[model samples]
Target: PVPVLLNYIYSPSTSMFVSLLSVDLPKPTLTVEPESSVFSGESVTLKCEIKGYDGWTYQWYKQDKQSRWSAVSQSEYYTVNRDTLTIRADAVIHGDQYRCSGERHDRLTSSQYSDFVTLTINALPTATLTVEPEGPVFTGGSVTLKCEIQSHSNWRYQWYKGSSRTAVSQSETNTFTIRSAADQDQYWCRGERDDRPSSSQPSNTVTLTVKGEAKAVLSIKPDKHVFRGEAVTLRCDIQWGRDTECKYSWYKEANTLYSSSTTQEFRFSPAEESHSGNYTCSGEDIGNSGYSQSSDAVTLTVTEGPVFSGESVTLKCEIQSHSNWRYQWYKGSRRTAVSQSQTNTFTIRSAADQDQDQYWCRGERDYRPTSSQPSNTVTLTVKGKISNFPLPQMSTYLMFGTPKVLYLIENNAKT
Candidate 1:
């Protein structure tokens, strides 16, 4: 154990045996004060700058993000102030690298090492929350809540609703409109900035369900005066809660008589009057709240009955999906065609009382509804013939044991 000569320093132009012993040294320049482009709750400030020199003693250096080169220790995102280092969390320094050096107030030493500064933590923008015409949202309308932030512009918006820290609305333009919305809601969004991690990271919970504006009722079942061939079913009632789904549209005087349908029936087996008119129905309930307020019309009238002229009447003309039909027969108008048959029955025969009136029929088939909407008007009525009454005097008598029959009537003179 014989060695006593420590703190050794000998560096004469790179002969090397140095702990640190200066004579000519000044290179410190580290700099980075609001300049390294930061964001996660930012607070940067680095400055070393040696230039003319002033009684030094500072020290800090790092390379990190795994390129490894340590010595800037103060932990938890740094704060070593002598020449100033203070980074305090830009989400813990991304891609980290920094430098600084000093040690001269006559401790004889070093200054050089500074150039390395590199940090860019800009990842705190995301705030999503979308629904500007994209949801079932409907309780009186008006819903536009898009706060989608990703970083391309200034950003200043905050809106929250469900867990409520209280913000419901605040905008520079990310959008937030609510007017009359009711029934269900949840929303979220946050993004604001003057600089640094000023806020962001609260989006992803947009519910906004709100539905209760549906009311379509059009129901025609078995009544509304129908009888051409009988069989009509048109139901479109609307509910809106327990699995209430819809997408049907069928109208008739307001136009569009369509029904490729999505359930809720609309049948018509032989229903005439050209399917009668004034009917209404609508209910598109899936999202974005569009069709549902249109249903009280219902005036379908098909009717036809009254036949007694000697009783033979039979005008039928059917085309239930086609088979050869070609029967016309109209008598009131249709330019009065009266008979062009393939025999779908048009018999009148035993009438003779001037045959009565109003009849109708149609069926011509080149296929697709080629002419078949007239039917349902049969009215015929004619009655005459019945007269002859004259019976007065007659007398006959026969008698035998207990049998006697007689009838006599004759009036003359007094009594």
Candidate 2:
């Protein structure tokens, strides 16, 4: 027994070195994003990678069950071309369980699984909104306002006046009737999704203003100082009435002188003696009695008188009392160019010794006349002709036949 123990103890102390190589496990990375919680129908991509392993083979595995695993059937689906492995996740396949395993030489390394990702799919709802007017909108006219949402499953409407929010519609129906015109108020509409509102852009505003009735008034400019044989006009202006089918009428002494069934100026050209009277005007109202009051009467005066200058003028008018009388002019009791009208200026064209005869202006008319009165007398004298002077004593001497003394007197007379 001593010999057997000695032999065992005599064996040399041999050392054995052992090293453990660390091959990193393949880690599954998410290259693609999952569907967002807010939006739906999205796409996702996943990739797997492993470090510390060169020239290593890879395999992809999906973990649907908590503890079980399944190989991805399609090699392209797993996409393990290199150390990095990628895969896609659609809307239907949202939940997790993805991993990658690596192998170096003949030894298999452990695997890394990806974190859980979720997916959701949603369908956008059909939505639209519109407005309707009950009737044609005119300026100052009443109208009905209607808001219509055609088919909005989960949407709301907002009504606005200018930049201010007026009303909101939770349900489908949104309408408002306005008895007044759009000029009274401005309106527009907007839409929103769910309870929270989106960016709102209002519709274009509609404006309305309607016209009512027409009105008119009369404006007249009358003459302050009117003269005979002078023309005048009565102007009719439609200040508030309709321009179409407007009429006018002018009257003198309560008698209509002119009536126009349209808008016109009634003009009197070269006014006469009878026209020297009261005048007024009135406006007709739609086949009814006149509405506006008559204008103040304008008076016209007829003046007749003679203006002249003469000597010894006994203006003989063959008649009686003179009242409202007109006058005429005469030369040598013969009528002149003057009428029964007033002359502003009168002058004799030729002044001769014959003009020294009696000349005067007399007043006359159809009713009566005035007696001619003598003006200052004028004496006519012949110049440079003493022989033309008549002498009674000389005429008796000349009548007797010529004696020697008569011949001497004749020679003296000739001298």
Candidate 3:
């Protein structure tokens, strides 16, 4: 006893560390996100939060209308990821109650079930997005995207890029515009509000192929003023593109004239007046760059007039630069067809009121569909045949009245 007392007295100024245990269970809080009431097809997130504690695994429960609770199973409609539960609202989930409880990892302790969070799902509306002036979407151009919902009023708009969770744009109006779109992307939208059924289902995604450019330079070979039978060529050049890897769309006024995939030039071996018009060009995507800008209009004019025939007297409707031409000869102001042949020619063999009329000729080829200018008119005048006749006889009642008697007297005198 004396030795024990001496040992206890020797233990001086010892500090002991002890941990206190808590018997009170942690209570979790359940919160419904994107509003408690939502439209069908909309996603509702239930977050279970337990404050002032760590290392807790959560279990979610849903109460049936019979007041019976059941563990939520993972499925297409319901998803559980850690402390969060996501429900895709549909017709069956109109009125549902949810609760959550936590289990600790460090010790064999659990949290009390959180208060119930009721969810009300309404019928979802159809949200659709449309693009104005639908066609090929150009880069650096304003793209107006409009969202329409099946029901509800005073709805606003929210725009998203691809499947991202964040909104790229939000507006009070139902229209979202991409001002000066610089690049291509997949865009989608939905209708939203500050009241119940906050957002509708996302609209179908629209894939926009935005090119970096919309400008081009269109040029014509030789000159904008072309002559018949002259070889003409039109070339569309994109500033940031290669000739081989790009395609071009050609327009005359508002009509599409041609589309070329291999070459940058639209060729006209022999230009015609029909080929003359205001032309524009756009270059399609080359590598990562988008279409080239539409080029400034280049006006093409074909000068048409008579091409002189080699022989003036021949009056031939001949086009020397072409082959397989069908020539037609016309006469008078009515353009009456006098003759038609491979080489149209007009020659006056006889003269008459109708025969001595103005004449002209023209050459046409059907192979490439071309018609030449008309030739100068020619006129003809005819005369009757000539015949030999005796000279004028002496007047019957004049000084030479007795021509026969005088002739006889002169004969007798000569004898």
Candidate 4:
């Protein structure tokens, strides 16, 4: 091909020769609407435009953080127009780059690629609210509501009660404390960053139900009237619910007999008069709230029976508020009708060695043969018999008779 010189003359005040050369190609410019910064599940539009150009085909490319680039295709996460790309879904990966370029009908004529624009997807932090001391709580108890964010720090907390959109509490901390919890108090919580106005979705609602205070009851194992030197057990029972791990306390009259005991049964071996008094019990919950209301008072009476030997001892059957009672005594498993009087008293006059045996007493009404519950068994100890010795015969007045009679015989012998 011979190079032919081609020139054109244009007059602009003077005639100048211009050579025919290659034409200049236009470069496309890409701009994203609403900026490249957006939250997840939001839509963004990418537009590629070339000035002074028409009938151009547009192509979009995407690059990830791993330095990999691929041509974008129409899918659930994205859609393509002639010169604009729409991100339809909020599933865009973070730190992704997007760009577009235009091509004309002539393959040789193409526009330079636009500057890369990074797509930053800000993921909303997750929040969860939990209650302390799970399960039903008692009224007037302390409880805490804690909000947790998924691996995020420096987040302010927002607390909501029931379905109300208004926040009950807002603070940099993630916990909400209820010093005295009330019934039917429902709560929810969320988290937000101080720098961002948007907040995470509200957490699941938690409904709090409060229970009434528990009552303690005191029970005695054997009869309330026990004999001295008998084993007795005082049990404290809770009627509200069953909790074996609850702490219990026992009180005798105005004094605290036992405190902070795991066992509900208070044992008294060989019960004495001192153990007989007004007894009450109380219980505490798992949170160690103040002790429950004191139980009804139970009166215990301990009576002494034939405890010594060779002594007059009275065996009384002590009954609670009853008159005109007859007393029946038992000696070594042998029942003996002792008396029928206003007072139930059985006296053992001059108690001998044979009286050393187990004795018990019961109260009976003169009108009926029925007897009350048997009293505790008491063993009586009697002293052994003592022996007597006769006095020895002695010679007397021998010294006085010796002076008068001059001859007197005195005999000292055991007869």
Residue 202, model 4, lDDT: 71
lDDT of 3 by residue, 24-65 (tens): 576898988875456666778899999888888899898977
- Model 1: per-residue Cα lDDT over 160-238, one tens digit each: 8888888877878888887657758687889887755677878898788877676789889888877556789988887
Model 3: CA > 4 A from native? 1-120, 212-415
Q: What is the TM-score of each candidate against the true structure?
A: 0.37, 0.24, 0.34, 0.51
Rate residue 229 of model 4 by lDDT: 63
Tell me the alpha-carbon RMSD of every candidate. Answer: 20.7, 27.3, 23.3, 17.3
Write the number of the candidate with greater lDDT, choosing between 1 and 3.
1
Among these predicted structures, which one has the highest lDDT? 4
- Tens digit per residue, CA lDDT, model 4, 244-343: 3578899998689999998889999787755778999988764625246679999987654333333455554555534565656677866664344555
Q: Which segments of model 4 are wrong by more than 4 Å?
A: 1-37, 40-123, 196-198, 222-225, 237-247, 253-263, 286-291, 296-415
lDDT of 3 at 277: 84
Model 1 error, position 384 (Å): 21
Best by TM-score: 4
Indicate the worst ten consecutive residues by lDDT in candidate 3: 406-415
Instruction: Name model 1 segments beyond 4 Å from true.
Output: 1-41, 45-82, 85-98, 103-110, 130-188, 191-227, 233-244, 247-262, 268-291, 296-298, 305-415
User: Taking the tens digit of each residue's C-alpha lDDT, what string does model 2 give over 313-396?
Assistant: 122222233344454544454556343344312334433355433333444446422323322111222123234433321110
lDDT of each: 0.67, 0.41, 0.66, 0.68
TM-score of candidate 1 versus the correct structure, residues matched by position: 0.37
Q: Residue 289: error of model 2 in Å?
A: 44
Please give the clash total of every predicted structure, in order: 1, 11, 7, 1
